[model samples]
Target: MKRRRKKRSTKQYAVIAFYEKNNRWPAPSSQNVKERHLGEWITRCRFIRNHSPEKLTEKQIQLIDRIDADKAQKKTERWMVNYEMLKDFVEKEKRWPSVNASEPEEIRLVNWCLSQRITRKNTPKSKLNKEHIKLLDDIGFHWSSNNKRRTWKESFNLVKDYYARTGQWPAHTRDPEESRLAKWCSKMRAYKNRTDTSVTLSPGQIKKLSNLGFDWTNSQENNRRSPENTNRIWIERYHHFCEFTTNNKRYPKAKSGDPQEESLYSWWMRMAYLKRKGKLSNERIHLLDCIGFRWGKGNE
Candidate 1:
């Protein structure tokens, strides 16, 4: 029997190629399935290298290190790299990394922070080092999703000032501050809708907002073209058409060049088409019939 060498899989080759092209490791959050798989594989390789070095062959270990330099580092060293990156970002930005951060580096830091929070909540205490948690705490990291820097009272006052200055509620605008207020208002509405007793709007907050004539529906229902409004508009137009017919003793000419007459002519044609298709309601048909309205092209 002849000895044969094991071949590297396509994924291994592809991941190496990807790292070479991008100059960065693929992220698990990548939308592309292949890239996501490569990212997850890299994560596993890093973990295995740190915990069970005997599981991976020397050649495989070298390949992973070539693609992901961090794989050569111990887990604690990797953790420090992420922690320093985040700490530097927070020091510069004066805030935690936002999930909505536009930069790839900031987004990576945000995800790293999120993972730490998840680990604190779900992972057993025995598996975690308290020193890491203490380091994060020293930097004012928020373990909860409510990571906003502003207090509720300050936000409420800001909204009041915004309404007073603009003479309208905070709208989602291009200005970052205004947009933040708009998001806060939207969040308040969402909290109000939540059935969970723990997620609730304070009675005082609700009263304060209500006094500002804030619509809790957060909708333009008054301006919406509802079915009832449409029906009323249709009837009003019909009356206008009837008056035109009675005065001229003829249907409005399609090419009359007068805007009102041309509009009525178009409306009449549409109604005729609807009646032919049996789409016009019986009540509307009776209304037209009472006014001796013709449903065919013969009248035109």
Candidate 2:
């Protein structure tokens, strides 16, 4: 007689075969899929379908349901917190959520509100209202009270631009020393206008005048009368001696024994007169005195 064969149980056919090959159970639901678990489940399914008898098991279905519940609960909690934070930030600040309070986006939003308020309250006409200037001064921005009306708008805009660019106000607008220098320069320029001459001299011109034995520290009229006038006299006397020597055909002597020498002797007398008047330079006077003694000795 033939004996009856026992049918294979589904768990023994499906799950036991999968576990023997892969060492993990199949996932119960799609929501239960995680990186490590999904990889294991896919590998096990392939192994079971290729080598084991194909069947669904009650135990495998219960395991998948448990994983799906856990995934749903975690996702719900994350969604609730994300939505609540977004809503609170937007409603309270009337802006989008910033990554942090000090982030550039939050600072930009604050700057935009300030700019909008300033724009809305700005007046186009040039009536002298000191409200904005006073407000800036109260916040420690300073300006001269005398010039405040003329510079109020400019000062206000400068402070606004400083804060907008750097996200902070400037500590000082102008240096005290720089203000003093500007005032001094203005006064000097005004004095130059009254004097009808430049107050400063070029270095080249100063060097050239020094070479010519001019003293600049003395007043202009005194300079003209002193070394300058004496030098002119010496030049004139030299020219006269040159003319006499050339016309007399002696070149370096006078027609009456020495015409050029006689002209030079006359020039020495003029230089002595200038020296007595405090007009001739010391070097020039010394040379003239030496030449005069020589001419007198020759005459004797």
Candidate 3:
């Protein structure tokens, strides 16, 4: 009598043949019925091996485990090879690889670094290997550019003295310190207006700035003073306000966590400020009145 073959050995053979021919594993969604069946069989075997190992025979168990082990080993080898290539590239270039590198190899390394950063950010610490994290950290790899910049407190202290003396935030000018402080103050205001930012001013920091009488809307006010300002621009903004009111049937709110709405609210506040100073034109006031725009206590 002929020797009996192991059950499901034919399916394993089919899967291996398919992978070798296509240079990819058979997918369950394949149009070919035979290939789809083989793909599903492999998937079931993998699931059984992971969740209920006892369900698989010794031959099936060995087949899946060996395939998985080989794939994992290859993946790990490739990762280490890329890591070494990145380290060498960085050493020679005296900088981290840029995605815009002229060479394909340098660009690939930059993408690999980006992938590593993204994986570390999205993956929980418990699920990630410390060894991999340590290897990258050893090279002084920066997860974010923010990590290398001056701290929030440092920027705050630098600007605090100037604000007290001048009664206004420093204007961005040719001077590096003035430009840096102005940019830093604008960034802080953005942090205050945004909810999705990873960095933000703490309650204590806000209180400290508040005590110093920091003008959060100073930048917005400065924009109006720019040479680009024109009556047409103001009329365009008025139309945008009318459109917003028509769409939402409500005024733009403060701290709404939307950049556009926050901008409209700031414009409304600017109008209120101009009105208080008797700088608002009678024509503009009449236009606002036509929209049933509320002023001061009536706005609430």
TM-score per candidate, in order?
0.30, 0.20, 0.40
Tens digits of per-residue lDDT for model 1, 167-272: 4566664335557888888788777877335568889988888787675666734323446445645755775676567546678877774545766888898899
Residues 1-300 of candidate 3 have per-residue lDDT tens digits of 122234467777777788789876665445566765665566556654654577667878887777667667877899899989988988898998753354657656755775687567645577787888899999988876332476666566656655543445766653344677788877777777784386877899888877776776745454323222244356557656665665466788877754456667878988888898999999678666645566653566
Number of the top candidate by TM-score? 3
Question: Which candidate do you rate higher for lDDT, 1 or 3?
Answer: 1
Candidate 3 Cα deviation (angstroms), residue 211: 56
Count of backbone collisions within predicted model 3: 0
Say what the RMSD of model 2 is: 45.8
Clashing pairs in 3: none
Candidate 1: misplaced stretches above 4 Å?
Answer: 1-8, 32-58, 61-118, 134-300
Pick by lDDT: which candidate is best?
1
Q: Rate the local accuracy (lDDT) of all candidates.
A: 0.68, 0.40, 0.67
Task: Candidate 2: list runs displaced more than 4 Å.
Answer: 1-39, 42-54, 98-300
lDDT digits (tens) for residues 1-300 of candidate 2:
112111223323454455467665443222333422342343333323323323424444444344345556765575445445444556686765322244554444433433323333433335323554444344442232222232322332333343345332233213332243234333333443444354554566345434544333323233334343344444445445433433343223322333335446555455556766898677555443422322332343
Error of 1 at 247 (Å): 87
Ranking by lDDT: 1, 3, 2
